[model samples]
Target chain A: MNPAAPRPAEPSASAQAVTELLERSRALTTPALRAAVGRLAPPMDTVAAYHFGWIDADGRPTEADSGKAVRPALALLSAEAAGAAAEVGVPGAVAVELVHNFSLLHDDLMDGDEQRRHRDTVWKVHGPAQAILVGDALFALAGELILAAGDDATAARAARRLAAASRQLIDGQAQDIAFEHRERVSVDECLTMEGNKTGALLACAASIGAVLGGADERLADALDTYGRHLGLAFQAVDDLLGIWGDPRSTGKLTWSDLRQRKKSLPVVAAMAADGPAAGRLTALLTADAKKSREEFEDFDEAEFAARAALIEEAGGRQWTADEARRQYDTAVGALAGVELPAATRERLTALADFVVVRSK
Target chain B: MNPAAPRPAEPSASAQAVTELLERSRALTTPALRAAVGRLAPPMDTVAAYHFGWIDADGRPTEADSGKAVRPALALLSAEAAGAAAEVGVPGAVAVELVHNFSLLHDDLMDGDEQRRHRDTVWKVHGPAQAILVGDALFALAGELILAAGDDATAARAARRLAAASRQLIDGQAQDIAFEHRERVSVDECLTMEGNKTGALLACAASIGAVLGGADERLADALDTYGRHLGLAFQAVDDLLGIWGDPRSTGKLTWSDLRQRKKSLPVVAAMAADGPAAGRLTALLTADAKKSREEFEDFDEAEFAARAALIEEAGGRQWTADEARRQYDTAVGALAGVELPAATRERLTALADFVVVRSK
Candidate 1:
């Protein structure tokens, strides 16, 4: 979005490789995921199926976007990093995916998001009650899947990890909601919120496969660190896209996060910068928020465009872009600490790169 | 409300014994429960603490009713039934309690209930978002607790049982909500819904301790049957209280279920009866529902009292009372099929009796 920010040229080969990995992971994970969801009772199962894009709202089969399945890919690759076949991580992959979707379902409702992946959100389609129940059902399924995947000790350990991460993720959401009512939030506070909201689950997804495959804690910890850094990079890119990415590509409205008055990285960083542009941006946002309190649809595209320019002028966009690159390198560096196979390490690096650079 | 419905006499000795059992179970479970909740991050822990009545809205310590601890007592007794110390069932007891409270937190929000236990509901005190997140956190804690309770096999078995029952519980809620919009719900359908909603969890609570203590499935099955019947009895009594119990004792308004237009057992059974009173009751309910759709809170005390009298005259009150007694006998009979210590059997019978006859 910022002309001064360096854009990494996408190598077609690396992009193709990551695409293949994601597809393979989805292929391995979908059957199990569908099976787990199928276990939900009637009407709930139908609502969940619609949310997953496996069927239309009318109950007929249809193909639609079901997210990138990034978490599942990480899980499968993590198992291989632990010296097991990808199939060994199928349960973990499915569990991570279920948890991810569960969060998506709830977050969309809480955030009042009407659309996801260019389709109506579950709450918009099925009403808030069903959305809440289906999300809860998916979470329960994740716990069941992880607990049944291995022997008692392994299952217990994995369940504990998932539970801890899920708690952090929920806590992060609580903080994010709290931040919306405040006038100012520091960069450090924003980072902490993002770390819990995004980093914890990604870390769990990366290490859970190793835990399920019986890898030692050292290897799992290394993968966790790798995924944590990758999540920061991923979220930074997401913040940038929320402001400036094309609505068609992002499958979201222009300035989506700003519309919700989210205290995401770009806004927090912009306000932290020292400049007249920052002050002007702050004054504009403060006034707009007051108006929004009475009439929520007060902002127009022109206003959002002006705010985006002010953010770039104040260095928020460039700083966020730089931060994404820095975190991506740190994530790749984390892999050097562990003794993974050369192919596994390369695949992990490629996946991290893809996450930081993808359009959606 | 109906003069013809027989009231079961409460024997002081049995009441005292059941109260002691509940107290002992709570004493054993509260510490572990507190410890688990203490692990939640800031603000969430506080919200949960308030919900549990450990603290009031302002965060000061307070002693308030934390339910009857019925499920925990059942769990401990089931463990003893399996030849294990009551201590062995503490984890299962704690998990079941957490799940029960989790459901309450979410249900209060979904049902828009503002009062519970003679105090404000969590959603009313905190916002809906916090209510949702805290409920989710509690549910996750439950899975973790049960999985960590015993050896891998035992933990996994217990988790599966809990998950199955949780799903049924959720499904029953969905059915209940659906029934609210329907014109007529058959009595059989109402029973099935109640079985899934209430019976499943009670059955799990009755058998989980046995499962954790490594008891055979046959014994667990017997206990499951006992709890299932007891749950039906328990629900029947709850349905009665929903309509006619004193507000001071029940912590609910008069005709609370009727206010929400819930087609509970009384209404469903009354509709099924053949008589002029049944026809008049149905006509009044349908007209009231239509009025309620346009402006809720349209019905006054006089109209509700009239409807209650009609329901009683239609034989709903007597039928539900007879059904509660029938289910109580069936539950007690199920206990006889399994070999139990005479004292354990007596305690179980007393607890069931307590449940069927409690004021709240």
Candidate 2:
């Protein structure tokens, strides 16, 4: 939401205030979600609780490490930026978070990645059975959370957009999974998949914020574009770091993408090349049935270097970063179109940058 | 659902008319669900289309081995029984099916089941990620379909019940998974879990039927009971055949339940028994690790025998069958409570018996 004119307080209070506002956002969501969840089909509480990270195996609370709550921030910030009342944004907070969590619950299962945010993926820990239910539960809750926003036709419109975006998100994830098994992946196809996978929810987040701001479809569409850019930038940076960043800092195995022969932009371009580097990469990737860790590690190093070289030669890496900047510019352009409160717009811009700049 | 009043009719006409009516049900649901699936949700159409057995991997019309249309049957039957206008029950038919399919999508994932109705389960083929997205897609459609019952209020209420039931179904599935690892799984717990897992949706099917009929809460409650009893009876019969029935006929691996150490009623009772029988049963169940085919075969024979012996001794199998009978009685009692045509009541009774008496 737009920051109000300075309340004669030092700037030092901003971070603490932001954290507390986030905490309040979460607190507001819990009861609202709980009430909505209660109305869901029976036995749904378990899935709901698990998705929220409230209960472990025995259904007891140990610790909570939910995601970064990025979507909610986008939503509330956009709403406030547009000068919507704070109360109006509070409930939408739940809608955005629910949608975000729902995606996570489903995406983890589809991606087949075993670890997320340093925790055993829900499916791995609780089995796919519960994970599926958990995802379904969140899906149901997310719909109700938005619908229960009741009278605000804008909110309802926002809910419809959220649903539409969810469909795109699902489709994007499918392309990503398909990319893993496909023989060749073009940059265009990868961009399309990444947009759907990452951009859809972020767009919904910002769009919902605009709706809360009483912005018309015109404003909402622009905000959607803004979020889409943020999402694109987010993925591009993540891909870059996946190969070059400190492994410990990134919290992922070093050269793990190359070792796994992931179809990331660099690897795909490198593999498409018809040179010794490509041949070596292909030989390592398509070798005999079995592969040992030592062999994989050595191959991973060579492939990583080759792919980096290919990225430079083809300008693929720069191209990705440039696209991110285009998205960023588009996002900023959209902000200019809206007559939002300056301070709130500034916060949203910062949040947009934060999306692409996260270390882990 | 109740049947229409009996009347003399030519055999050819009756058979022809019945086929038309059955096809009519398919006609109502197909479009509602299909329209809800957008190009954005790629694998949703794939997974859902697969569940219906409508398309092969490449997405083409095949022989539709869609589920037996059980939920729709109840809706239409209830509507006909109540003599409600077609407009009322028609949308309910679509709603119930959507809810049923939505549950099936998640249930398959939660159970870690690899196949369903002779096809690869959603998670197995599409992977958990797409399976989850598909399930969510189905859920959104279910709500949307329910809300199609004319006007926001009626649709909202109907959708609310469905949302509630979806939660319970998920919760029940979670309890089922949790029971798998627990040391002591009481008979009551299994029964309760089964109720949530199976009965909740069945109850919802009938309740939706009543709602379509414009039946009051009492009538809806009666349908709910009928659905609950029928669900339990259905599970009891399934458990019975899991051990004693011919695998060729049932199309399941013979005595697969025992091999899996499933805590069916007889097994639970046997485990709860005194002395040697209980000890032997405990020894078999506490070993959840994989078993040799021979060991499994031995356990199969022993489990079948032990269950029969316990059913004979503790009267558990007889008790289970009796419970089935009790549920059937309650269903009939529920039917009695509803003010439908005499012929309709008889048909519902016949259907109830058919549900209980079936071996497969």
lDDT per residue for candidate 2 within B170-272, as digits (tens), equals: 6677677677667778888878888887787777776776676666667777777888777777777677676665776676776667655677766666577
lDDT of 2 by residue, A73-107 (tens): 77777677667765566556676677667778777
* TM-score of each model, in listed order: 0.91, 0.77
Task: Give a tens-digit lDDT track for model 1, residues B1-360.
Answer: 322222356567888999899999999999999999998777789999999999999999999989889899999998988888888888888888888888898888888889998999999999888888888888888887887888867887788888777877888888888887788899999999999889988998898988888888888889889988889988988898889988888878998888878898888999999999999999888776667444657667988898889989998988888888888888888877788877888888889878887888
Note the chain A TM-score of all models in turn: 0.96, 0.81
Q: For each candidate, C-alpha RMSD in Å?
A: 3.2, 6.5
Error of 1 at B185 (Å): 1.8
Instruction: Estimate every model's Cα lDDT from 0 to 1.
Output: 0.86, 0.65
